[model samples]
Target: MQPVVVPEPDGSVRVAGRRVPRGELPSVVASADAGARWTWDDTNRWYPALLAAGVRVERAHDLRLAHRILRRSALASWPEPDAPPGPWDTLPPTPLTAARDEPAMLFPAPGPGDDALEPDPVAELAVQDAVVAGSAAPGRLRLLLAAESAGALAAVEMFHAGLPWLADVHDAVLTEILGPRPRPGERPARLDELAHRIRAALDAPASLNPDSPRDLLRAIERAGVGARSLRKWELERLDHPVIEPLLEYKSLYRLLTANGWAWLDAWVRDGRFRSEYVVGGVVTGRWASSGGGALQLPKSVRRAVVADPGWTFVVADAAQLEPRVLAAMAGDEVMAAAGRGPDGRGADMYAGIVASGAVPTRELAKVGMLGAMYGGTTGSSGQVLPRLAKAFPRSLAFVDEAARAGERGEIVTTHLGRSSPLPGATWHEAQSGAYQDDAGDDDVAKARSYARSWGRFTRNFVVQGTAAEWALCWLASIRRRLWALGVSSSALDAGAVPAPFAGRPHLVFFVHDEIVVHTPADLADAVAAEVEAAAAEAGRLLFGDFPVQFPLSVAVARTYADAK
Candidate 1:
């Protein structure tokens, strides 16, 4: 393939030769070698406009995202020993088109994350490619980058396509749960009644607000209750007439504030809720929503997610994803065999553990495995831990080593080489103070407590992060398969979806280990098949020859809430 450069901010700057007009970008990208991988500073900045302009690429390397991975990855071999780690370490690289010395993208200042053009992105790409190629595990890292880049593309597409939403249904659900919509500056009727009951039972003044935690705590104290806070668990322990009403009030209040009428007005537009998803937002590689709370659609509001006439939603969720992932990554034959089961169904891996006679019961097996992964050291989970250890020692040892490494302030990496974050300077200072000559027992205890707290985080990181990678693979596979499946044969689309996504089965929503596809009714079964096929493909793509499998509970329905 020949290299052709067009340097007019249309993502052809990497080749560094000539300029191309904005209107000509589609033709230029189209004429270039079909297999050429476009190198860009950031996919979010450049790709969106191109996609809006109806241009898509087969392959591309996002330099900023790739650089962030390769530089710190334990699997990569950095050729530049003395290179400064500044600027690139920060999250969300600054936009290329932003003005100098001004607020640009993610961060509001002109430092670290704000400087998008240091060390030359082109040169950085070369170094990263070299390092990854020379790494001990190049294939895993390479697949990770590919999967990550594909995720970036998928995120943009999802944002553009948007999730089909019905404002009327959302309003109906909110009204059913919250009573009539209150007037401006007024509380809902149900919440108001609960607040009154809470104050009356506590013998507080009629004007006392149950929403204010401090005021409610004072009221509880005045009522001869031992509660110091209005937290749910703390309130549950208290035996008071106001406790039940207060808990109910808090629950209704949260739902009203989070996804009530105002949310519908702001988020729902043209029958879609277009959430801007942040790719790799979490440290564990999970996607986070910028607006609309797309990732956390509670069951109360899920009923609002209804497909258009003659269209349906294909919902699928991975079963016991983390444990299945652990089974494959650790290469533990016992756990892998259990994960695969007789029919390659990963249905409740903990149940499989019990059937294998690793533990006495399913509940014990469940908590024991959770304890092993999450560093639980007391209660029912801790009691069953020993039995689980002897049964699946390899998988048990994997997380145990990670936890120990974290306790020593050492960074542990995921299966795909994303390293756990280092403890902050304040954390290090606390640890240092504990080690000093004048340090007391409390200081050391506090330090150890903090270390163990972080240890729990790192211990869960490997499994969760690798599970995230598998999800990316799954999504990418589903996207490809649906694209290959083409439009449904009935040749009708009632959804009235936007261009590019119209007449197509498109991904509408995704949470951890679960996804929903909005498809024409005729293609609903096809989408479900693709979703299940993608899960199996994801398992194979990540584990290769491993016996472990990832299974999905799938449903094709007209509404999101009906899937479960």
Candidate 2:
């Protein structure tokens, strides 16, 4: 039977009406039946300890993640609890981390005058079950919950595995670009030189800091550059000597601060850069990093992500994921056909649009599609939108309806039932104020702009959110395939690696649409094949029998930069 692990006020767990001490929880989980799925209040709180104890769980139902989904999803009519602000309603996710030395604190002991009751995971699970069963689309909601829980597992595992990093290589790259590291609160040599050059070019005082936007803007106006801001694009437009050094300073300054020597020391240890990945952190279901900026690694430092000896990195990313998702969601065969190749594999969707004469060039096709999905009503994108709408009316209409729903302050859901948040009270006020008898033109224009901006948000939310679902399914499938591959291969020896994943290919890094698997060099080819198969399976799981292909650009290399 599946077990529901509920944390007690004293940090013990109640399982099957018997109390399991916190110390023995790992062994109990490890001894459960092979097909058992554990339900818990928060996976991050419980699973990390289980993992540290060398116990691996095959399946889970994360109550916190599910509750967030049900409470916001428009398809589910979740009933409010009898007591206002129940414990489950206010429960927060346990913070994620890469440390594995000890079990996470599951629940704090109530102090004097602390009357808050402990949250009951079993109760929350039952509520979620009822909500899902009585919902408009139970199957889809179930799939979403499962995928979300699986994503949590993947997130913890990736942090445990950690990305391979070569500190020496990273140091060399920084030295080459930033002219060596400097003391804290001091600029690097190259940055200092750039600052001096910028000052000379602007004929400004030496005290003027190039890093300060306000100070730099004042200096630029004093120099008669006629620039409004220090933005790169804005500065590039002006014909002035300060432009080049100023831009270079900004670029190097970002690298020095974001991923320079300081970051290397704090995040990387024992040749691994462990970043805490927060699954479903974004409202659209995309991940966010709690620390170590894992999702924003710049190209300048990618060369430092070197695989271990006798191992390689298999990097794969979906090509044009969102647009292709739109095609499938709208059931626009014309749009889908543009991405389908003669061999039944996927091709460049934008290129296919060009071939179909939807737009004259590939660039225009790309811009037009971006405009349609993102609500770009101006510039070159605007000019090409009409042609695209004429060519693919179904796909265009799909987003148009979503945009219109947002304009009227309606909640729009993704294909898998993750709904966009409702417009705030301020939005309602602005909208209502515009219709008042004494409302002026300014009120009307302000309301119109806010409505359009919100429309843009909802228009992209459906496509982007569905694309995130597709990515989550893709990640879960890849994890299963990689584990199975490791289990089936007898020759693979993980003795040199860490426990729990010693003889297995494991996911080390994941961004929105890309994944990097660190695997044995001999299994690189097989891993590549599995990765492709997993992408196909993800498409099938999300859109059964739909011809919208989720083709990936796969590469196997010793380093991340080389893979690209």
Error of 2 at 403 (Å): 0.4
lDDT over C-alpha atoms for residue 119 of model 2:
70
Off by over 4 Å in 1: 1-18, 30-36, 79-87, 90-119, 492-495
Say which candidate scores most in lDDT: 2
* Candidate of highest TM-score: 2
Error of 1 at 556 (Å): 0.6
Query: What TM-score does each of the candidates earn?
Result: 0.91, 0.96
lDDT of 1 at 526: 80
The alpha-carbon lDDT assigned to residue 501 of candidate 1 equals 64
For residues 329-380, write the lDDT of model 2, one tens digit per residue. Answer: 9999999999985566789999999989889999999999999999998999
Name the weakest run of 10 consecutive residues (lDDT summed) in model 2.
98-107
- Candidate 1: worst-modelled 10 consecutive residues by lDDT: 99-108
